[model samples]
Target: MGNPVQRPLPDIEDPLYQAHFQGLKDQQLRVQQCDACGQLQWPPRDLCKQCHGDRFHWPVMPDQAVVYTYSVVYRAPHPWFKEHLPYAIVVAELENGLRLLGNAFGADVEKIQCGVRVKAHFQHDEDSGVCFLRWVPTTS
Candidate 1:
């Protein structure tokens, strides 16, 4: 698992993930919650990985998370991310016990750290109807 030197191919959007995209536009961070076992998961899905449950719920996140790990990229393999090159990509543990992966926005390289508290920041792309959830350090 590494930042590749070439652009990863574009992915086909799954209709199942559209709900999650809409939730973000509503200013809510949505995660897949297992209707069977009550497990909250990111990367929206039609089935729960834990118990093979076909039902899931989209729950609003608590708006709080802690950085579990992070990586600072000095370069981006693709031009699309060039403006945000030298940024931080992080795995954050949400308050609801789900770990979410996203780019950490508004953070300085010298200030980023594991366990840093962050809050969800939403960006809407009307052209694509995509809502991205990035993170910004929260003031303690």
Candidate 2:
């Protein structure tokens, strides 16, 4: 892990998602929602999957979610994650009934379970200058 890129930065491949990154950059969690049918979606597509409409909106996500499913990665796929061996990649269901995926942020790696309740934590990376989201265990 010798100077092998300390962290991953946001990908600007699609302009539609720039608002998402910008939302995160400002410490607000945003998700894709339909302006037509009010359906929440992910991966930031051009059209709403439910209503088949092109009107999309990114609403600030709530602070809580339940772990839908998760997997621990022992072997660092990229060198940047080498220091964080056995980290968890989690998919959580939002209060609005949509699923989002991110690294389990502040929770103990050992106590991770399928139904664990977590609070969303947003932090700005000094290296990448980007705000990223992670999930931490919460009692309420």
At residue 61, what lDDT does model 1 achieve?
78
Q: Which numbered prediction scores highest in lDDT against the true structure?
A: 2
**TM-score for all predictions?**
0.81, 0.87
In TM-score terms, candidate 2 sits at 0.87
Q: Which runs of model 2 end up more than 4 angstroms from their true locations? A: 1-4, 105-107
Per-prediction CA RMSD (Å): 5.3, 2.1
The C-alpha stretches of model 1 lying farther than 4 A from their native spots are 1-13
Per-residue lDDT over 28-86 for candidate 1, one digit per residue giving the tens place of the 0 to 100 score: 87878899998777776677878879888787878789999988887876765677767
lDDT of 2 by residue, 49-138 (tens): 888899888889887899999988889989878877878888888877777777863337767899999877777787676777787878
Best by TM-score: 2
What's the residue-level lDDT of 70 in candidate 2?
90
Quote model 1's TM-score: 0.81
Worst 10 residues of 2 by lDDT: 1-10
* Root-mean-square deviation of Cα positions for candidate 2 versus the true structure, in angstroms: 2.1
The lDDT of model 2 is 0.80
